[model samples]
Target: MQRTAAPRQIAESLTELWSPRIIGELDDSYVKVAKVHGTLGWHSHDNEDELFFILKGQLRLEMAAETVTLSEGEMFVVPKGVQHNPVAEAECLILLIERKTTLHTGNVVTEHTRSLAEQLRSV
Candidate 1:
């Protein structure tokens, strides 16, 4: 058996820009924290939905139909296979709930997706 405390610290002690920390994981799902700036590329998860919860600052979610702005304490879910991009005008903190096998950016294979494997960890 394993035990961990609530409110885990996910960001690395020295990382800057797009650092994701694993706060908690259970069964087939996990929670992650990320410090984000700039724009993430358009992508989608083929087999899973992604839930994004804004923790601090603001974020803009762009889809083919419309762009939605989420503030602190707000949240949005991107359905499976629905292309979307997340952008932040400034540094923002967000919590992501997703499946353990879900890729950060689907099959795009861009620089952003390259580090996804390293970003995930057991909490």
Candidate 2:
């Protein structure tokens, strides 16, 4: 089947906060969308980098050394092994590009941590 996904729409339609839904795949990567607010725990991917694109609202990426803010249409890539925490003051829509093996919350398991099976389910 041939289909196209509207990332923003998919993200906006999400009913769960901090839960990411898989929308598409590219080679070894997965394209995902999530509706988020508040802050996600600090975590790091030991092997794969992660990309975050702001579809709506803003994101504050706090790192071990510095903090970066991204608004709508902005994107940033967090390098592998770099500890980061994503925070949003209000509800935000985000698109995530990451390797299929990348864990949603990296090595840390918290209340917000979601399993691959959970993330792969229909939104």
Candidate 3:
């Protein structure tokens, strides 16, 4: 069976904050959708770059050098080894494309951080 991925609809259905639901996969990456509010701590992936696409609301990707603001329909790529924190003033719906081995919050493990096992759980 060929299943289609509806990012916006899946995002709107999400009830948890900063918890990403896997929707699809391409080669070595996993396509994930998440509803986020506030911040997700500061961290970095030493070996993988992360791509973020905003599906609704707004987001601020704060890196050590500068902060990049993303609105609906916008996307940004956080290069590998750059420390960053994702913050949202209002609730946000987003799609994340990351490597299969990428950690939820990278090296920083906080209460909000979701493990790979948790991220892999059925939504």
Top-scoring candidate (lDDT): 2
My TM-score estimates for the predictions, one after another, are 0.84, 0.97, 0.96
Against the unseen true structure, what C-alpha lDDT does each candidate score?
0.78, 0.95, 0.93
The runs of at least 3 residues in candidate 3 whose Cα sits more than 4 Å from the true structure, single-residue gaps closed, are none
**Model 1 C-alpha lDDT per residue in residues 17-67, reported as the tens digit of each score:** 565666777789887887789988899899999998887889999999889
TM-score of decoy 2: 0.97
Lowest lDDT block of 10, candidate 1: 5-14
Predicted candidate 2 versus true structure: per-residue lDDT over 1-123, tens digit per residue = 648568898898889999999998999999999999999989999999999999999999999989999999999999999999999999999999999999999999988899989999997
Q: Which candidate, 1 or 3, would have the higher lDDT against the true structure?
A: 3
Query: Which of candidates 1 and 2 is the stronger one according to lDDT?
Result: 2
Error of 3 at 116 (Å): 1.6
Ranking by lDDT: 2, 3, 1
